[model samples]
Target: MERWVGKVAIVTGASAGIGAAVVEALAKQGLIVAGFARRKERVEELAKKLQGAKGKLYAVKVDVSKEKEVIEGFNWVKKNLGPVHILINNAGIIRNNTLIDGNSQQWEEVLVTNVFGLCVVTREAIKSMKENNVDGHIIHINSRSGHRVPNIPNINVYPASKHAVTALAETLRHEITRNNLKIKITSISPGYTETEIIEAAGLPKNNYKDIPAIKAEDVAEGVLYALGTPPHVQVGEVTLFAVGDKS
Candidate 1:
């Protein structure tokens, strides 16, 4: 943590949930944290609350699904804040529809936001890190669905997008290692987190209430642990689940 003080970090989907929690945690550790989200006002409100913290928080309007917005956001960070030292790819979405009867638009939305968005951000962040010679860390806020499909219904293409993320993490890791770049990549998968994403997916309230769930801050703690590790140590993947969660 001490090593990262006064450094720069970017957290996507930072208006709420896991992304918000990660932003707060990193900022408290004295890093210049940038919170990127479509709902820029929410991040601005959060930044106000974080006043007098160990580090500063900057709220940037960015829809990760948009390539132009992503590029501009990174450019702003580089010109204003400095090169990026850490990137937490936490932005994602879900739709409650089955494949056989699912709306293609819903599936596309899920894929664009959860998969393509992550890739764009990673590419831009890596460019900054490599150009500036920063041995940074990249974390994907993946889901248990990335590893295995839950028994729940109507998850649609959400799980498939996550599985792509799972593979992307490894693919990026190999690419970085082969290039002799010191950048580290990790995939943190959490099972059934208590976040708005579930509700937004249109799951019944009773469904999630009956299941074991982890808090967003718990997942943030995992990110902290990963970032706090020695430079030589790279946590490849971390899967988190509530104690009683069967899946």
Candidate 2:
């Protein structure tokens, strides 16, 4: 944490939920944070509230699903905030449809945003880190679904996309190791987090209310725990779940 003070960090899906929480936590730690999301206004509002904090916050309009927008956002950060020292790939989505008889568009949307979007952001961020000789850290906001399929229904390809994330984290680590790069990659998987994502996925509001769930802030705390480790310590993965959650 002390070493990261005055450094730059980029957090995707930062308009709200876990991403927003992470942004606020890092800013308080004196790290310049760039919040990237399509809902630029929301992040702008958050930035205003974070004024006078130990660090600063900037809002960047970006839809990680769009390659061009991702590239532009990274370029802007490099030009204004210098090289990226940390990247939190927190953008993800879940559609209400079953793979047995689901809409192709919905499936594509999940894959594009959850899988492809993460890859694009990682690539661009790594490029900046390498060119600048920064030993950056990349954290993926994965889900319990990434490790195993949940018992929930109509999740469609959401779990599949997350499973891909599980693989991506390992693949990126291997790639970095092969090149002898000091960059670190980690995957943080949380189970049934209380966020708008569940409602947006078309689940009944009561469904989440009745279940044991972790707050978005709890997950943010996990992010800080990972980032605060010693330089020689690389946390490969951190999985969190509510105590009451059976699975």
Candidate 3:
């Protein structure tokens, strides 16, 4: 929105999929956006293409799974771009395995990336916002599985991680209100989306092909809708999926 023009926004896991789309949209809205991902070159490449947009995009190489790296990335953003006005916690991962006999390493990876990583980034971003006395917004890109377990198999601990996101948003909201902070927290859960996550998770190719899905851009639009509202109007949660999606 015009109110946040020239302000700073951070999008994690921003090299591709939902993260990429969200960051690009924020940049075009005139926010100084930073796209953080381990595949820094991918974000940098996109940044190059967005050079003529209303705002600037910076690519920061960060693997959100590590706390030290996350801290450093936040420091860079603070020192260079002032404080965070918006934060899109979009970094997440899913492994194709069942919980009963699933690979422990894979589950650990998912927990680290989806749960712990998100918390660390949020802490830093909220810290920046509080320190600067800015009323910022934090949006968590969750999944429908967070609300209900899907019928699909081998979703592993993905749903559990997302459920944590659902609880986290509420907890953060409570904390904000108790602390008398003006910050807003929202969780936007999207159903099966067309993204590299499916392929990267090694889901069955045929299943992905048959599943009706929404575009990553659609989720990005929902994010903008949340950010476009007035400060007093806190858009607590949004759930979006393709019309034909039965899941």
- Give Cα-based local distance difference scores for all models: 0.94, 0.94, 0.94
Against the true structure, candidate 2 has what lDDT?
A: 0.94
- Displacement of residue 124 (Cα, Å) in model 1 is 0.3
lDDT tens per residue, model 2, 1-247: 9999999999999998999999999999999999999999999999999998999999999999999999999999988999999999999988888878789999999999999999999999999999999999999999999999877778879999999999999999999999999999999999988788977788666645655989999999999999999988999999999998975
RMSD in angstroms, all models?
Answer: 0.8, 0.9, 0.8
lDDT of 1 by residue, 1-247 (tens): 9999999999999999999999999989999999999999999999999998999899999999999999999999998999999999999998888899879999999999999999999999999999999999999999999999887778888889999999999999999989999999999999988888978778676766667989999999999999999999999999999999986
Give, for candidate 2, the lowest lDDT window spanning 10 residues.
202-211
The segments of candidate 3 whose C-alpha lies over 4 angstroms from its true place after superposition are none
- Model 2 per-residue lDDT at 221: 96
Instruction: State the lDDT at 213 in candidate 2.
Output: 89
- TM-scores of the candidates in the order shown: 0.98, 0.98, 0.98
